[model samples]
Target: MKLRIAILGTRGIPNNYGGFEHISEYVSEGLVKKGHSVAVYNSHNHSYTASNWNGVDIVHCYDPEYLLGAAGQFAYDFNCIMDARKRKFDVVLIMGYTSSSIWGMLYPKNSAIITNMDGLEWKRSKYSKPVQRFLKYAEKLAVKYSGSYISDSRVIKTYLKDKYAIDSRYIPYGADLFTDFEREQFDQSALLKEDYFLLMARMEPENNIETILEGFSSSTSHKKFKVLGDTGNRFGKFITHKFKKDDRIQFKGPIFDNAAVRSLQNNSYLYFHGHSVGGTNPSLLEAMASEALIAAHDNPFNKSVLNADAFYFNNAAEVRHLVENVQRHDTEKTMVQNNLQKIQYQFNWEKVINEYEEFILECHKKNIHEKVIPGNR
Candidate 1:
């Protein structure tokens, strides 16, 4: 069935933002190519000002987020929902609930509403207790309002089933296989292949950025440690100031160039993934696709994706030990190869798009059937 879909809950695509936007970009384009009509809601302040991207329609909503800080997200989400009410979309896919679930009641009732229940936001260490409580309420509201739900990790799917009795669909994030350049050195800096370490993520408490940095700083290795993300935020500033004394650590800021990012991941001797609260992180998938030797924080979300193919670390000491001890042995090569195979067979973009299309079609058909039968409710 050719479905008309509208995607919301991101800063909007050509992906200058994080995971939600990244997936939205690929999913929208992919759906359009499959004879489906898709529209992505972009923020007015987004860099790309176009009305269309590829064959998908782009609806720009007024976003005061730049001026209002955190409060701006509510306004942006409100605008998107209000605009969606006027569209003819058969499926309205809300990507996350952190800033948008409060308006769940205002969502287009005619469309089959599907919420992508992102990682347990209330568990993030970055949020205060009061904020966490509010996020819990928001999650409940999202479940109450959406016609269907999607969980990116199996852990989250199980949690939703256990906590709310909601059987959410499990759809993990996808990544592209890194084949741009074979042995292409990261030309952004003077760093050589297999000589430096890498960590790319937003600077946040839940991400265990401080823990990773502390471990790297204490390690005896002479390799340069590169941290890539915008370090202008409060936590980022704190991390930069705290690690300034360590000359080996370098803050590279945000790098959006796909080739450069993949090259850096491909060339790094060890790539550290410190995310502890998310469900199937996009960066982790990209690292796996790049064949990067991963050292992830020991957590269910990361473990579900990496399994035994990646080295796990719990504390700063473990990080330091891994940093000092891990070498390019035959096992390491085997692990990297295994991760690449997972990317090709399981987490590739084609599989993700196909799964999404099938899921959306299924939800739409159920909604239509329910409306006709009424007793099917």
Candidate 2:
């Protein structure tokens, strides 16, 4: 069935931002290709200047986020919801609750609100105690307001089902198999390819970036360790300062260009995924797609995706053990290849998008099927 979909949240398209933007780019474009109407909201400050991208309409909303700090996200979400209400979309898919839940009441009743409850946001170590408390409340509001929920991980699906007693649609993020990339794009230092290990993540405490770096530093391995993503935040600054003296660690700040990221992933001897909280990280899937030997953070979320086909590490010691004795682990290459096969079978972009489409259609159909019998006449 054809549907008019409005995707809210994120800085929007062609995905220079993060995973949410990446998901929006693929889903909006894919839905358009499937003969459905798709509109994605972009921040006025977004890099892509165009009003449309690959047949998907882009609506620019004024984002004063830089000046106002966190308050600006609320403003952006309210503006998007206001615009969306006017459009009268069949399905309005909200990527993450965050600020959106604050403006949930403004979302049009005509639209079927489907929210992606991103990880356990309040549980992140990044947020202040009060902010975390607010997020916990926001989670409740989001669950109450949305017609349905979309979980990016099975672990999350089970969380929502068990906590709120609602069956959230399970549709994880997808990544393109990096069979081709600009091989020369990587910095000369990180150009060692299979000799160096890679750790690409937002330098946050909850992500265990420091833990991974600590382990890598402690190891006697002669290979260089390549680190990506920006160190602009306070946490980032602290991390950089802590690891600055290490000549073996190359801090390639925020390589947003997809080709460069793919090149780094494809060439890296090992990919270190330290995200301990997030649900089914896109980078992890992309690493699997790139056929990198993965050393993922040991957690229920990561375990659900990587299963027994990964070198799981719970702390600095475990990571160090893995690094120091990687050669002793003869099954590392076999596990890496198995992860690649998992991407082919389970995490294919086409399959992910098709599932998303089906879920969107299902939400729309349920909303339409709601019957109101005449009462108290």
Candidate 3:
């Protein structure tokens, strides 16, 4: 049956950046091809105005600068969901339940609400006490009201089950094959000239950027270290300045182009994933797909994503040891490649999108059946 679907959260369709935004674009396109009428709620800051975006409708949301971090995201997403309700969509998919739960709870019952509860946001050290409490409550309400819940990692699904008593469906992020141009497009000339290690991530405290920089700096090896992403905050600026004189460490700010990033990912000898929070990071998955020798933080979510194929480090010493010893193991590189192949095969966008299609169809059918059965007949 043809269904009108609306995707909420992360500024919609042409996805300039952010993982959730990319997922929304991909899934919306896929559903459109499958004959479903799709509409994505766009943020006011986006370049595109409310119009038809590749056969799908775009609904614009006003963006206010007063709110910051998760709070800002919540404000925008809450507005998107409220707008979706007025459209009378057959399915409304909301991403990140932290602030959007209030609107999800109010969405019409006939509109199948699918909430993508992105990996444990409340556990992050960044939020204030009241914000954390609000998120926790919002999470519970999201689970209670959502017709279906989606999680990207098994770890997240388990957390939802244990914490909210909600069984969430798992659909991991997908990967694209890197072409020759894509593999060589980024400005990696400096990196290629020296023996360099690569680290790419947002300069957030939870990502352990400081620890990685400190660990690499303390190492005796003359190898260069390239860190990607912006250093906008005080902590990030402090670290960048502290390591300014250190020729071995280079901090390259965020690169927007996918092909440019793919070049960096493919050329790097090793990829350092220092994220200490969240489940199934897209950067880590992208690196794995590129078959770079992976050195990741030792956490349940990291281990689960890498499937024990990559080396795990818990401290600076361990990171240093890996830098010194990583070159000695040729077999390890092959293993990384094998694991990358496995992940690529299993986590393709086509497969993930198809699974989502099935899930939504199942929910629609169930909803129809429930409505048909009269209690007082």
Candidate 4:
């Protein structure tokens, strides 16, 4: 059935931001190809100013985030939700509950609201205690207001079922296999294949970027440790100052070139995934798809996706040991191959899009049935 779907949350598509925006970009385009009319809500200042992208409608809402900082997100979300009210969408898929869930009461009453519960926002160390408490309440509000839910990781799905007693659909984020890039395409001529360590993530406390960098600094290996992501933020400044003495530790800032990044990941000696708070991270999946030997943070989210296919670490000391000791042995090859297999068979973008289409259609069907039968809701 043809459905009108409005995707809320995120700064909108073509993915200048993180995982949510990345998924939104692909899923929005994919749904359009499948004949669904899709609209994505974008912030006013988002670089992509076009009214439409890849056959999907782009609704630019007035966003004061650049001027207002974090508080601007709430206002932007309010605008998105309010605009969604007039679209008459069949399914309103909210990507995260961090700011949008508070306005849940105002969500269009006619739409079958489905929220993708992204990570445990309340547990992020970046937020103050009061903000964290509000996030906890926001989670509940999302659960209360949405007719259906999506858990992007199996671990997150379990948490939703155990905590809220709601059986959320387990739909993990996906990545495309990296095969088109040539080794020589790497922008940095100084870096050689498998000669440097790579860590790409936001400079957030919970991501344990400091812990990974600390381990690299302490390690005996002389290979360059390339840290990617915007380092202009407060924590980024502190981390840069603390590690300024180490010549091998290079902060390359944000690299948006997809081919360049994939080449780096594909050629890296080891990719350090330190995301401790999120569900199946897009970067982690990309690293796997690129066949990088992974050393992920010891958390249920990372562990579930990697299993015995990658090395695990918790502290600076462990990271140091791994940095110094881990060699590209046959076993390491097996681990890399295992991760690639996971990407091809399970976490591929095609499969993810198909699953989302099926899930959304099913929910729309149930919603129609509920409306037809009074009190069934």
**Rank by TM-score, descending?**
4, 1, 2, 3
lDDT by residue for model 1 (102-206), tens: 998899977999999999999998899999999999999999999999999999999999999999999888998887463354474655888999999998998
Better of 2 and 3 by TM-score: 2
lDDT at 335, model 3: 66
Per-residue CA lDDT of model 2 for 1-377, tens digit only, reads: 89999999888898887889988889889999999999999999888889889999999999989889989999999999998988879999999998999887898878889998999999999999999999999999999899889999999999998999999988998887775335555554746658889988887899899999999999899999989989998999998899899899888899877777887887787789999886989999998987788889889999999999878898999988988877625687789778888898899899999999999998888887762332311
User: TM-score of model 4 relative to the true fold?
Assistant: 0.98
Could you give candidate 3's per-residue lDDT for residues 1-377 as a string of tens digits? 88888888676668766788878888898889999999888888788775887888888887663457545776787677667767868787887776678765567667777888897777777777887788788877888788788889889989888877878899888776665666566566634732578998877777877777777788887778888888887767988988888798988888777776766766676779998777677788778777677889999888887776888888888888887777726678776777678666877788988988988887777666766884511
Alpha-carbon local distance difference test for all models: 0.93, 0.88, 0.78, 0.93
Q: After aligning candidate 2 to the native by TM-score, how far in Å is the CA of 306 from where it should be?
A: 0.4
Off by over 4 Å in 4: 181-190
lDDT for model 3, on a 0 to 1 scale?
0.78
Per-model tally of clashing residue pairs: 0, 0, 0, 0
Q: Give residue 153's error in model 2 in angstroms.
A: 0.5
| Cα lDDT of model 4 by residue, 110-195, tens digit | 88999999999999999999999999999999999999999999988999999999999988989988865444566657559899
Candidate 1 runs further than 4 Å off: 180-189
Error of 1 at 334 (Å): 0.6
